[model samples]
Target chain A: MVKKILSVAICAIVLLFVYAPILLLVVYSFDSSKIINIHEFSFSFELYKQLFRDQKIMQILFNTVWLAFAAAGLSTILGTAGAIGIFYSRKRVAKPLNAVSQIPVINAEIVTAISLALLFSMVALYRTYFSLIVGHMVLCTPFVVLSVLPKLKQMDSNTYEAALDLGASPAQALFKVVIPQIFSGILAGFMLSVTLSLDDYIITAFTKPKTFDTISTYVYNAVKNGTNSSTPALRALSALIFVVMIVILLVINLRARKPANKGA
Target chain B: MQRFHFSRKQLCIPYGLFLALFVVIPMLLILFYAFTKETDGNLSFSFSNFIGFFTSRAKLSTLLMSITIAIISTALCLLIAYPIAYILARSSFRKKNVLLMIFILPMWINFVLRITALRELLDLIGLLESQNYLNTLIGMVYDFLPFMILPLYTTLEKIDKSYLEAAADLGGNKFTVFTKVTFPLSMPGVISGITMVFMPSMTNYVVSDTLSNFNITILGKLIDEYFTTYDNWHMGSMISIILLLIIFLTMLATGGFKDNEKEARGTNLW
Candidate 1:
């Protein structure tokens, strides 16, 4: 009983450490107190209003969502194809291919970003959305493949054989037998890709078009210049984001549970 | 083609082409530019760019400072993360998954947002009042902590529970069990997490640029300054090439990449 209590305490403490700053951000988003010291506080929607009212923030938001979706979709497709190709191949080839695919995941992002910048400049694709997309795609595809490959590993080879023996064509066998089994993995991979693309700042900073600005880059400039005094507005934006993350994580957990319960 | 079979040889083209274009070719270009110079008459390959970087006192100081910061931050992150990862892996608590979720959640948010949030938080605490290198180091650790924790958590989770139990049963105390059994067992995770955090922290430009206000000149910012402001492509590529070589040398010196390969193989088992 003591051990269990200690475990709970440990878990709770870590969770607090993780979420306290975020909670503080959320609470302070509504705090009437401009300064950090808040002996007395009043709830207000001023920050939220200002966040919406700011035209530049809105543009950055649009750019962020646009880049996230674009990078996520392209990388997901490429990574899905790569993972499936490796899954379908013999073991010896797949092993080396898997390792090679993972090099980007482990390489220093700065190095990768700089390398991409050089490559784009050489190819005369620098400062274009195409360069940004390709850079993000190269960075994110390996993660998607890594996430999805485990699901493929769990799949029985005989299932495809059975489908084939039942007169299913190769295409039918893949679309019908393999993909259905790996749908969850595909979804997880997509989420991972989107998150990585959305979170990416360094690469985007290097390769992004002059006119385009990601949310990260936008916020970065604000913090760098220190002219922006609208702290509450940024806090409000982070608060909303924190809520969105909670919702997404809850959904993932709920989905993860369903499978295990069904299996049991 | 005789037939469209998914053979090992066939798989080589896409992966090979992508790696060559993205990794190999650019690295070659950087190296070429690193050793080249603009002659009075025409461009020529020379060693002046490389020579200049090593000889420049300010640039050399910046590179050393960046290396020192990376080493410090990597050490601090590992120290803090190991204990937290230990609890997560060893504990039989309710809501373990939820706790793990919280630990990993920061990673999902935009890196820019997280760094910005920390900057605000530090400002609130008045840590940003003075341009403290310690504050900058803290920011690096905070930003890269998840990279350390996640790999460590995964590795620790895979450790056989029996090893710890056996250690305890053999009259080893908690610290002994941790050092002799747990630490050795989780070395692969430690290696990967360290490499994951260390490499980025070493090469990262934005964290220092934002948090430290360029008071600290890391290699990444040096590369950026040359490439962006000066339009000195030769110098920029030289710095980048030197950065990559240092990374390669560090990887060899620490045996970081070899352990990562082992970790990769072990992780691939399931």
Candidate 2:
């Protein structure tokens, strides 16, 4: 009984530590005062109103969403293909490829961002949507591959061979039998890719066009520039993002339970 | 023999090209920039950036300070995360996913927004400016604790209870069973968690820049300063190469690239 109580206490404390900052931000979103203060502010929806009224912010929101999906969609395809190739290939080729894929993950994001910037500049593709999307792809693809490789490993290795032997063409075997088996992993990887692309800032900042702005870059600039009109609006936007994210993820989680028929 | 089968080369071609284009080529660019110098309307390979880094006291000290800060933050994260993971793994909760979800919920928000919120909270407390190191450490620990906990929980949850039973059956006490059977078995997760937290804390300049109000200077922040602030590509590339070597050495030390089955399972992090 004491052990259970101790465990619960520890969990609660840790949760508080993690949640306090976000909760604080959520509260600041509602404050109408110009300066951010914990207390002594009237509760107003002014920031939310401003967030909606701003045309540039609104357009950037859409751009950011489209960019996220496009990048996630592209990376999912590339990363899934890469994972499949790595898992099925000979060791000599697979080992180096496998290790190489982890470079973006293991290396610092600043380094990755600058490297991409330099690469883009070399081809005069710097600060274009194409460069930005590729930057996100670099950020997210390795993770997709990492997530999918495990599912491929957990799969029955001979399923592809069996499908081929049973008169299914190679493409048919891969598309039909193998892909279905790893569908859960791919779905998870897709969700992760979306989240990663959405949450990314460094890579987004360095690779994006000078005129472009995502929620991350906008909020980063707003905060860094200090108390301004957009800063207050960004507080509202951040709070809304947190709430919407929770709602979407909760819905997905509840929905995802139905397809978790891995063993049962 | 079959009429036709998929060959390895065909499957590997596209991604191999992508990797070469982005990963291999960009890396080569960094190396090229790092080793060469632009002089009198011509570029020549030289060791100036590297020599400058070593010769400059400020640069070396910045690297050392960054390492120290990273170590402290990583240690704090591990200390706080382990017990939470252990409790979650050992509990007999029917809806455990909900609990795990609570821990990861912070990650859903834009990280910059989250740090901005932290800045406000610290501002209210009057600690943001006065306590630079402590506040930065707090932000690092907060941003990274979930990364540490998730892997630890995954590995701990996978531990066979029978091992503990066997140890207890051999007259081991609770602590003895943990130290002998449990801790040893969870080494893979511990290693994974360490690398995940350690590497990022070293280079996540965003946390320090936000939490410290652009006061604190870490190696990552230094690299950005060179490339963007000073527009010194040669120096920035040199610093990146050095940081990469440090990361490589750290991964080697932590067995992060090992293909052990247990390690792979532990490292299946999202």
Candidate 3:
């Protein structure tokens, strides 16, 4: 009984540690005050109004979406090809290559951002959206590969062999056999890449064009300026993102639970 | 008898070309610049950049601070994660799945968003104004808890409960079984989780930057300052090179590349 109580206490504390601050942010977003003090909270839509009307914020949002989508598409194509390639090769080479692909996922984003910034400056590719896209893709492809490789591993080797034996060309085998089987994995990987690229702040800040401003970067600048109160806008945006994400996850989970007959 | 597949050469073309151009070549360029000097009159190869890194006290201190923060955050993450992971692994609660999802859901959100949320929360509670290091440390611990929990949970969930049962049947107390059996068994997960937290924690400029403002200057922040605000590529490159070397050596020291091989073979764990 003591053990149970102790476990429950630990769990509760951890939850509070994680979420209480988030709740506070949500509360302060509704604060009518210029400063973010939760105790003096009063409802206000002024920040949201400002947020929607801000031309700079809108431009950054567009840039962010562009980078996220472009990187997601590129990583999915390259990552899927890399996974499929590694899946077919001998263990000696494949294992090392797989590890090489995963290093970016585990490496510090700051290290990577700095490296990319240096790379672009040295190569004279700085101050361009292409540099940002390339930087995001490098980090994102590994995650894509990580998500896709497992499904590839689960595939039976004989299916490919059987396709070949039945006189289906290699392209035909890949299109008809392998592609259909791994489509869900690839889709999941693509979504994961998009989310990661969208969320990335450190690398994007370093690698993006100086003129560009992502949502996170905008928030950082607003906080640092300390002249204007932007907390409400930031919080409202976060809340909207959180709600959308949760709904998407729930829908995906429910869809996953449906009968296998509906899977197709 | 099999029809032709895309040759390995053909398949590797685009990705190989892209990786070489963007990933490998750029790194090599950084390394080259790190070891060279741009002469006032004409650029040339030299050791001045590296020498400057060692000579700078503040830059060196930032490196040490980063290492210190990474170690502390990783240790805190492990301590907080292990018990929660244990409960999740051992408990038969009806809400276990929901609980697990809640634990991991934070990771899916934007990292900046989460950190910002923590910042606002701390500001409201007056924790951010703490005259000491409490706010930064606690903020980091909260942000990184999930990274530690997920890996530890994976490792703990795979542990055979029969070992615990067998230990109990053999007249061993729960503590004894845990110390003698469970703790050692979870070492792989522990190592992986520590590595996961450590590497990222070490290089993250944002967490320290936002949570502590400019008061806590770590290595990543140093790099950002030089590269952006100062426009000092030589100093930035030197710092980048040193940081990369430290990271590379750390990876080697941690047996990172080798451990993955053992993990893939499923033989790394004792």
Candidate 4:
């Protein structure tokens, strides 16, 4: 009983540590005061209203979401195709290709960001939307390949052979037989890519066009101006994100539980 | 067979080209920039950039500080994560996956926003104004604890129960079984966890920039400032190369390269 209590206590404490900052941000979002203070808690949605009204903030948010979507979509297609290609190829060709794909994953983000920035400048494509998209794609695509390759390996290769033997063209066998089997991996890869692109800041900061501002770079600039200069709309943004997170968690849990219930 | 080989080669061409242009060429560009100097409308091979990095006390100290902070944060993350992972692995918790998901959910949220939230909380507690290493360490561990726990949980969960049972049958106590059997078995996870946390921590400046209010300088922040604020691409590239070398050495030391290649498909991020 004591051991159980100890374990529960530890878990609770860790969870508290994880959630406290976010909770604090949420609480501060409703404060009417311009300055964030834990004690000065008068309930209001003024900050959130301001967030909606601010054109610059809205533009930055739009840029961030659009960039994430475009990058994730492109990378998912390229990475899935690459994974399939690598999977089908002989070991001699695949080995080096696989190794090269992982370089971005293992390399430091700063190095990757600056290296790409330098490359863009050298090619005279610096500070363009194309550069930004490519930058984000480079950051995200490897994980997609990594996620999809495992599913491909676990898939029964003979199914493709069976389809081919049944007189389906190679393309038909690939799309009809092989792709469906690894769809979950492809979906997961897309989600991972989206998440990675959304969270990225360093690469975005270095490679984005001069006028383009993601939420990350915006927040960074705000904070850099001064701690006190951090906008209350940022607090509102955090609160909004916190709510969205809870909704996602609930949806995921519900979906997870439904399948388990069916199995039972 | 020959026809199949041709198609496979054709399918791989796009990705192979993408890797060559982006991955291979960018890396080469860094090397090229690091070793060459522009002088009198001509480029010549030079080590002046590297020499400048080593000769500068401020830059060298920043590098040292960055490594020191990474080591400290990595150690702290391990100490906190190991026990939690152990309990999570050994216990017959029905909702373990759910719990793990809850831990990882924060990672899905924009990391900068999360750190911004942390900065606010730290301010509320009056720690934000204190430009100290402890503040940065706290921020680092908070951001990276999940990375450490995930790998440890993965490996720890896979350790067979019979090994523990055998140890107990031989009269080994809990501590002995853990130290002798469980610890050794979990080394790979521990190493990977260390690598995951340490490598990013070394290059991450946002944590320090937020928590310390831009008061503290680390290698990553230095590199960023050099490239963007200072307009010193050559120096930045040199430092970047050095940082890459450090990462390569760390991966070698921890056997990360070998583990990654063998299980190249697994999403170690999870």
- lDDT digits (tens) for residues B48-140 of candidate 4: 999999999998999999999999999999998888888888788787756766665676788888898888778778887875688899889
Better by lDDT, candidate 3 or 2: 2
Q: Which residue pairs clash in candidate 3?
A: none
Q: For residues B97-206, what per-residue lDDT tens digits would candidate 1 score against the true structure?
A: 55665676676676676676666677777777686697778778877877777778778988988888888999999889888988998887887776767767777777
lDDT of 2 by residue, B15-85 (tens): 77888899889989999999998898688999999999999999999899899999999999989989988
Q: How many backbone clashes does candidate 1 have?
A: 0
- lDDT for residue B81 in candidate 4, whole number 0-100: 87
Q: Tens digit of lDDT per residue, candidate 2, span A153-201?
A: 8899788889989998888988999889988778767777888888898
> Which ten-residue region of model 2 chain A has the weakest summed lDDT?
A255-264
Which is the leading candidate under DockQ?
Answer: 2
List per-model TM-scores for chain B.
Answer: 0.87, 0.91, 0.88, 0.92
- Across residues A146-254, which tens digit of lDDT does each residue of candidate 1 receive? 6667778787879988998999887788789988887666766677677778888888888899989988887787777774454558777878887887678667665
Name the runs in model 2 displaced over 4 angstroms.
A154-169, A227-230, A258-264, B1-9, B258-270
How much lDDT does candidate 3 score? 0.72
lDDT score of residue B128 within candidate 3: 68
The share of true interface contacts that also appear in candidate 3 amounts to 0.42
i-RMSD values for every candidate model: 5.0, 3.5, 6.0, 4.0
TM-score of chain A of each: 0.87, 0.88, 0.86, 0.93
Ranking by DockQ: 2, 4, 3, 1
Global lDDT for candidate 4? 0.83
Residues B94-185, model 3: lDDT tens digits: 74545666776666677777777777777766766653256667767877787788767767878998999999999999899999989889
